[model samples]
Target: MHAKFEIFAAVAPGLELALRDEALERGFRKAKAAPGGVRFRGTWADVWRANLELRGASKVLARIGQFRVTHLAQLDKLARDFDWTRVMRPDVPVRVEVTCKRSKIYHEGAAAERIERALAEELGAPIDPDAQVVVKARIEDDTCTLSVDTSGELLHKRGHKVAVGKAPMRENMAALFLRQCGFDGQEPVLDPMCGSGTFVIEAAEMAMGLQAGRSRGFAFEQLATFDSNAFDALKSPAEPADLAWNFYGSDRNAGAIEMSAANADRASVGAVTHFRHCGTSEAERPQGPSGLVIVNPPYGGRIGDKKALYALYDALGRTLKQRFKGWRVGIITNEASLAKATGLRFKPTSAPVAHGGIKVTLYQTDAIT
Candidate 1:
């Protein structure tokens, strides 16, 4: 492999700008926003650091190579010439996935099969249908781009917090939303409808400068070019910064509260996080600096009747406006009407975000007066 290559850090569709900003801030000088992801140029260590540190990216893919191919014969020839030994191991099993768009090689299965045969015949690598290491081939505009999935599992897994609620906010989404709210980990955060405590736990982890992948393994560890010692250095845990109980979450369901608390405990953020059983109406500001209040409430269509949720949104808006003065708020929900029901004047909204299978938007308010 070349000493440097293009790295694509995939994120939630609506969060492309956020991830790009995050990468730039983290010193990825070449980071730029692209469709569905942020792209940067860096060495192998950069890939490892991205997987370890980026909280907003879903996965980090290293672009191995790309070429223009108009026919299956050209693809097969290029695949055979591609240097698979640079990234893939002959012993480690890998899966190949191909996507073709606006290209002459329109058959995805045929493209994948050609690449698989090349890897097996040239590199002597075993192909597994269910392997963690994935080689992705994308044929777009007659250009074939081959990349490796360095992040085995979705970043949100985090390997801690196995407990989840019906509509739990993903940790990656929570981190980006927190960034959108201008959270710097110096203030307290509250989630009145906290599901599985994603926001609170992520906030605590951020405050302590904890590496997001510290508790998990990565697919890069199984690759041929992987440096265990150098990667281990990256995994060296940072000292947890001294912090108080500034992160808090609450839910009306006892089961959800239990899950939140357990998740927090498993994440090792319990010391700085507190989970309680309370509805939005009962949520109160903690006795300290006011911070962000972010929530991903049920979309009503899935959890309850749309008509019934208006009252819930109204009560939530009223509670925050009445009590959470000087604090900012971010609401992620599908319906603009539902967000408007809050009666909280939000700043200009952004494009809708795809959460689960539904489209949601982040409604932010200037510091509540």
Candidate 2:
């Protein structure tokens, strides 16, 4: 039987091209992009490696089944007919989220009700609205497709950052932003306002050839037919030779520095990055030459403190220009005007990342020529 899997990638909204390239590099030949997700076909091995190595993906889901239905009756039948036992654990509580768009199954409540009923009847698991296993329904153009949320929570909940202080960016988002800045292991990386050290930690981890999934578990393990032996064999080896720590991080807040040190220690990435405390204006470039510098500073958009943030971005821009020449830069935020204050040539790639209810884009700039 040809195994069908859903490999989801983090896209930069208008920059689907970037995401496409990442998918192709992962041995996914027929990669196609959709709104908020990507659909691709691969084998069990592909699924394992994609989950293990693909940095751009937020989650890798196996499309257990999909059906087209026009009426409520068909929706009920489809959910009941799916081999739920093959994928979902009977003991685990599950949640259903439904979306309707240009379809006859227009009632969201009815759709959720039908599926929830099927799962309860078949599995005898009570429906907890905030359960671990989530079943998603999408109705578009008279077709209703059902997918099990394989990675229960986002993959960025990478299990290590228990001491997440300040505004911590997701690991999945940090990885994509690093790729957006052309990180190829050949360049030095830096995050000036490295709160909780997400960017720096991700960079250091990648540089050390560490598996992102090694530190955490996924929803797939709870499902039936999840081969523990297959998955365990894919994990990167723990023992490795010493490598260079080209990634660096700094923050002005003393508490942030302390928190980052602890977070990085838990993450086992102290060998990959150097953490320091310094204001953006007084921050110094690394000892090496040109590399990428990324920062996900607070925009004050969600909290209504944009004025003080403007000063911070201003100081950051001057630091990059004065210390690091011909170095690529990336800034993730919801505020475009705040990013424009940096005075660097920014390519506004609309990032489909929602942090603290703030959907934003990463404004990146090329090296000064």
Candidate 3:
């Protein structure tokens, strides 16, 4: 059997463009973009790089096999046909996640049962959902595609920043949003709404040459062909920096400020970011050339109280136009109406990125134009 491998990097709906761009930069090519992911061809080493390098993906899946199956019997045959001995070992427990869409065999439960049985009987193994070795099954348009999840506990977990504010942004989405905002670590960066300081912490880490996946282990370690010595050699200690956190963030909520500061401190970026209890009305623009400003405020999707949120957006817009000069601005919001409240003339540059179960558009303005 060939070791042909592909990758599925989970992304927000609109953030696929950014993820695709990232994939291309990392030598991954022609990824098929979907609502929540991007699929591309790669190797086990490429999979390792995708997990360690992709800032926008929530997780990475390695495609193992795929075949056409119109019925349960066919699926059974296909499952039995795979080189289970080559892929799955008897000692390792495997979990199967099946998603069926537009297929003749629509019984998802039965499909799971069939795959589970095949793994146990044909492959001689146990089934466990939360185990390290995961096999995901998707039956779409009568095609059965099987993928092994090489990433464990989702790449977004990042294994850092235990401190979080109310309605904190996920790390993967935050990284994608920052990239869409055009942050490249050379300019001053600001996150005025700075809940738990996710954006600021991520930005600081980015600026300091830190890998988002540095702290976690991967499911590949459980694979039969995984190279432990190579990955071990790639591991390096987090470098200590004496540089002050050039990134700045402020929030009207003192509790949020406290939590964000703590998160930054834990992420070893406290020295790279400055936190304060200030709203957009009093938020000071970052010192230096026109830099990027990102804000993830309550957009009525994750946080309740829509009436108050509209007013908040209006205030944010006025604050930017009146206070921030020669500085670009980016806002994360679920709906267009809320973005319009900013009153800045902007064309949507990035597609809708998903956040908190809602697709959010990243709005941008060129230095208050």
Candidate 4:
């Protein structure tokens, strides 16, 4: 309710720092990067704002309460006694997910059952397996920490992207990758092999000062502490900022081009985003100042044969080298040799980031001469 609580913004393992920077820039108090997320302290209003505005977070969790319990009876009693009414509405349906790590109460199912029973009997809340409002319980080292998933759906599902090509990049990851490439939304961004226009649309939205969660709903709205009027105030319409640059995306597949355009339109960034059907070798620099060129090309792990991809990478490299003067490049792939095939002078690869199932890295280059 009125009291401040610890908020955790979950992100991909390699992108915690970028999310932390975003949280701090958004004025979250004491935002710090942990292993897989960024943690900060804020009130319920801040929780609403976080679910509404953060671009890099996969989910925003509000840590409601925590206590030490070594046995199932203790867990049941404590869960029943905890002030669930302070946070959860008795009429709302809720689901519980529990994970036990090196704890005396190690049965996750049993632990979840106990908590669900407590909520049903004591709090008078219905337990639905498919409920959007989740109560995540993590029991580790004899301590149980209960947190509510304030962001119902993953933040990456911004609700606009309906069509996608194979091995599409997620929006949250794309936003963080843009940030890692030093994009502050001032200059143009071009994704030469843009699968679904994720990077391009995200850039356009950021340039126009669009909130990432504008088109979506959140689980926090169902909480008892949620103030509809206050949350509506936080949803104040974002005035589009005038921009001097446009975002561009191109792909060899015509379907990909169509998908990108439709997604851009759905995101309300069609005015500033351009999608065209073209192979990587045919990708040209847009008619503007030199800016960032980021691509998520096919690798052996996800798509295409490794042997044939060499020529594709080489052609991509030659095209950029000959045509994109003064523009920086970022290539994300699971293979170092494929990135090397580009023949660009890369600075260094970033930490391995989990994409789908493969571990991919972002290989960056300085501005081409």
Candidate 5:
């Protein structure tokens, strides 16, 4: 195996800064921001740690090596010479994906064929169109860079949340948003419009110091360089702390509440998360110390008609303003008008974040008076 290599932690667009901070805090060496992700360098151990701990990344890619190629002949020659045995297993199958940009050899299909043939013929490894392990080949500016998708499944699949609501928030995005809201796991969290209890469950897990990847398996485990014993050691996190305060969630849909409770139970945070069926106007402040109230309410143009959402936002604003004193709020919405309808005085906004296809921004507030 290579002594050191470059690893890219892929995060959602507009969340590179948050992922960078998470990487640095996790003690990844020289974590720096790139356009779509954070780049760091480490050995295979660092790759395993990143897959297990980083919460903001959707997937992790390890840059095995790169070479400049002007033609398929050069690519074939180089692909055969590279030490594939160091990373890929002869017994397992791999899927190769190629993308070409601004290069003479712009035919991605032909390029992928040549590379796949080289791997199959020279390394004695099988090529399966559907495989858990992926090898990504990008030929940009005449440079052919090969990287392995160390994260087989997406990082957000924590393996516990089997049920999700329509337009549910991803676990990774929820973790980053909680961090953006200055949540240190010390404050209680409330999600008034909790769909599947994503915010409440994530907050409970964070407060308990749970590892994000504790319940799932990763693609890196199939790599040749993967150390099973070392990985087992890394998987042993400290015991989950006993939280004194509980997280709360309420939604108008009974199905959503049932789904939230079931998901929380599967996640092992059911004791600390309470889910109830109620509308935004009927959501009362739970009995607990004032903390953070974060919600991603429905927006028009995607899930509902825009014309009918104003009253919903207005009721949410009125409820928080009149009942939730001393609490801070983070509202995620694509339309500023909807946010303004809440009538909650928001501080200056942060950068717009991309959720699904819509671009949403987080509007935060100081302590509610």
Candidate 6:
């Protein structure tokens, strides 16, 4: 475990730039956007901080070591020769995942088996398929790059949200979508179709200066190199700002409203988050200045008939345009016609992002006059 190593923050494929921006804003060194993630150079402390603070990352991986290997035997011998004790404890269990592309070792199962054998037989580490700690080995073009997953569960878990509505938006994706909508946490945010309150809660947390991982634990805590005291020091107490505006969420389903309120309470943002049971047509602007109105309404791919959703989008657009003057809007959907149905003058849409196996795009509008 060197003082510094290459760290990668994995995000959804279309959100690499947003993650890169977040990384750079957090002062990560040499944060560069790639196809699926952002790469940076930092120490173990940086890795811990990234897992704690980055809201857009799905996982943080520490690139521990790499080597050029042509065959399975070479990988096995090298895995055995590597100093596992430097980063992992023998008592803790770990699972090895292997992916091969244009490499001599094409069999992923065999490669994983060899790595597992090396850890079990050579290093005396227990191998479990369900272990929280993961060792990712990517054999690409005959080069083996070894990395460890520092965030145990997906970062989207957030650990506090236990209840969810049908086809709920993931917390990580919600946060990035907020960023894409130019939300800076200084203004009010209302999600008209706030299922499970992800967008509202995330906006409230950001406004309060709360860390995304405040209520969660990380897999790095189980690693041999993790320093408890140092990590503890990194968790500076959150001194929430005195916010002037509040976050709002409205849903037609009473169950959704209940779930949103409960999740907001669990996340410690209940004071600033307000959830109400109301339909999109009934949504009205808050008392304060107009801010961002972001919504993840149901589309044809996720729920209901495509024909029925057009009226829903039409109603939502009519409500926003009529009631929320000077407020910007963001709508996420898979269908272009659905977005067009809103009748809001939207700027060009963002790149397509994979959500629940369907590609969705964020259609945003300038402030309504």
**Per-prediction CA RMSD (Å):** 1.3, 2.6, 2.4, 1.0, 1.3, 0.9
lDDT of 1 by residue, 84-201 (tens): 8878899999899999999999999999999999999999989999999999999999999999999999998899988888877788988999998898788899999998889989
Give the per-residue lDDT of model 5 (tens digit) for 52-134: 89988899999998999989888989998989998999888998999999998988988998889888988888999988999
- Candidate 6: TM-score? 0.98
> Where is the poorest 10-residue window by lDDT in model 1?
236-245
The model with the greatest lDDT is 6
lDDT of 5: 0.91
Error of 4 at 24 (Å): 0.9
RMSD of 1: 1.3
TM per candidate comes to 0.97, 0.89, 0.91, 0.98, 0.97, 0.98
State the displacement of the C-alpha of residue 116, model 4, in Å, after optimal TM-score superposition.
0.2
lDDT ranking from best candidate downward: 6, 4, 5, 1, 3, 2
lDDT of 4 by residue, 1-369 (tens): 678889999998999998999999889969999989999999999999998889999999999999999999999999989999989999999999999999999999999999999999999999999999999999999999999999999999998889988989999999999999999988899999999899999989888888899999999989999889888898858665667889999999999999999999999888889998989888988997999999999999688898989999999999999999999998899999999999999996768899898999999998999
Q: Pairs clashing in candidate 1?
A: none
Better of 2 and 6 by lDDT: 6
For all candidates, what are the clash counts? 0, 1, 4, 0, 0, 0
lDDT of 2 by residue, 1-369 (tens): 246666555443544555566678767888887765566877655666666676666777666667889999988888888778877778888899899999988999999999999999977778998887788888888787777666766777777887776567878768877876788666678899888888888887777777777777777777675788888887878555276437888998888888888888787887667888888887787776778889987787664498878888888888888888888899887878888888888875754566667777788888855
Instruction: List per-prediction Cα lDDT, in the order shown.
Output: 0.90, 0.77, 0.81, 0.92, 0.91, 0.93
Question: In model 1, which runs have C-alpha deviations exceeding 4 angstroms?
Answer: none
Clashes of 2: 1
Q: Give candidate 4's root-mean-square deviation (CA, Å).
A: 1.0
lDDT of candidate model 1 versus the reference: 0.90
lDDT of candidate 6 over 1-369, digit per residue (tens): 448899999998899999999889989978999989999999999999999999999999999999999998899899999998889989999999999999989999999999999999987889999999999999999999999999999999998999999999999999999999999898999999999999999999988889999889999999999999999998858665678999999999999999999999999899899999999999979998889999998899688799998999999999999999999999999999999999999998768999999999999999998
Q: Which segments of model 4 are wrong by more than 4 Å? A: none
Query: In model 6, which residue pairs have backbone atoms overlapping below 3 Å?
Result: none
